[model samples]
Target: MSPAVPIPEDVREEVLSLAREGVPRNEITRRTGVSTASVSRICGGPDGVSFDRSATAAAVQARVVDLKAARIGLAASVLDDVQLARQRMHGAEDNRAFLDGAKAVAALAGTHVRLVAVDKDDSSDTEAAKSMLGKLAQALGVAAGEDADQAEDGGVA
Candidate 1:
């Protein structure tokens, strides 16, 4: 068996300092010639250190859930605004502009909905956003469907 390596007091302090400075444990091990496992033990291990990986991960997951919920709420609100805009454009001559704005709002709402779905499914937020955006764009093409030609030329009834 290899002899156990002792981390000197000064080296320990340096490692702790580097950890506090946001250097990763692996990097600290490389710089200090300490074993990666030892460095982790000294800086974040159960008995020697205060860092709690499980707690940190739980907190991050909670935050993500909160953010995703907020995104969904914002999307719903925008969709409501779009509906109101459509209602207000009734009997108005500028139906085209109003309908265009409503379409934009719907697109944004669809994006947020997809984002929330992604979060619910445990996908990365960035990836979810991109996927949702693509889906929203495609969905928008069929948004008006059979009403398209009529809505474009005819004012809201």
Candidate 2:
């Protein structure tokens, strides 16, 4: 019989890296010149090998999604607070509080968009957020970009 095919270690590593990067098995096989069976064997075997860079990128993307969701929720909460404060406003101080809450809502909205961009790793989201934030800032008559920066810096904006 002819000799058995042996998978090279470098090719195995490349396949594992591609897989971790969300590349499909067949794609990895094509890119790395490895069989799909070998790629599966390396990535799914009991040895538990991993491609750390791609795994970490995936994790960061997941966290970005979670953060964006939290930011949207927070924006909704701020809107409610603004409405309540507006209803209870008795004077200029209360009006200021309402404005501040509005600013908070805008900031959170910007953050939500930014997180979405980061998660997708796409410039399109960034451009969309910028355009949306500009319109929102104009409608709210507040400095949303500054507010977003402050919120990100203070961890509570």
Candidate 3:
């Protein structure tokens, strides 16, 4: 007969699923009733495992979907707070109060908003990126190039 499998496939798969789902390693240990050593082995040795090379890659992918959904829910909940901050910013009784509220709003927005700059140096594209960017910015009600920096820097645009 073949030598006994160190960790049964089903058990290993279960351990991987729990780890990818954001469960703490200790909790996974308790839940799976597997020894700490086994958990460590399955999750990759001491340094931890890379998702690409790990056996639990599929489970990790599933967890990514869950993480994205949680992020959407959190962003949605923050909408109400954002609206309130706007109101507070508008209704400040003094300059200091207004500045406080404005700062809060700006800081909060900074956390959730991301600016991505995609530079495509590929010469194969026929159209110039600068012109395309300009059009896109205008259509989106934003300033282009230098004007964009001015707007973001609080200058009248």
TM-score of each: 0.41, 0.30, 0.41
Best-performing candidate as measured by lDDT: 1
Which regions in candidate 2 have their CA more than 4 angstroms from the true location? 1-52, 90-157
Per-residue accuracy of model 3 over 52-137 as CA lDDT, tens digit each: 33537878988977877776666655666778898998998999999998888887666555311112245744367777887887
lDDT of 3 at 31: 91
- Residue clash pairs of candidate 3: none
Indicate whether candidate 1 or candidate 3 has the larger lDDT: 1
Please give the range of 10 consecutive residues that has the lowest summed lDDT in model 2: 83-92
Ranking by lDDT: 1, 3, 2
RMSD vs true structure, all candidates: 12.8, 17.1, 13.7
**True lDDT of residue 41, candidate 2:** 84
lDDT of 3 at 99: 92
What lDDT score belongs to each candidate, Candidate 1 first?
A: 0.73, 0.70, 0.71
Candidate 2 local lDDT, 1-157, one digit each (tens): 9886888878777776777777877778789888867777899876565443676689999997788788667656755665554454433366677676566656655655554454365578689999999898796756666678889899555
Worst 10 residues of 3 by lDDT: 113-122
Least accurate 10 contiguous residues by lDDT in model 1: 44-53
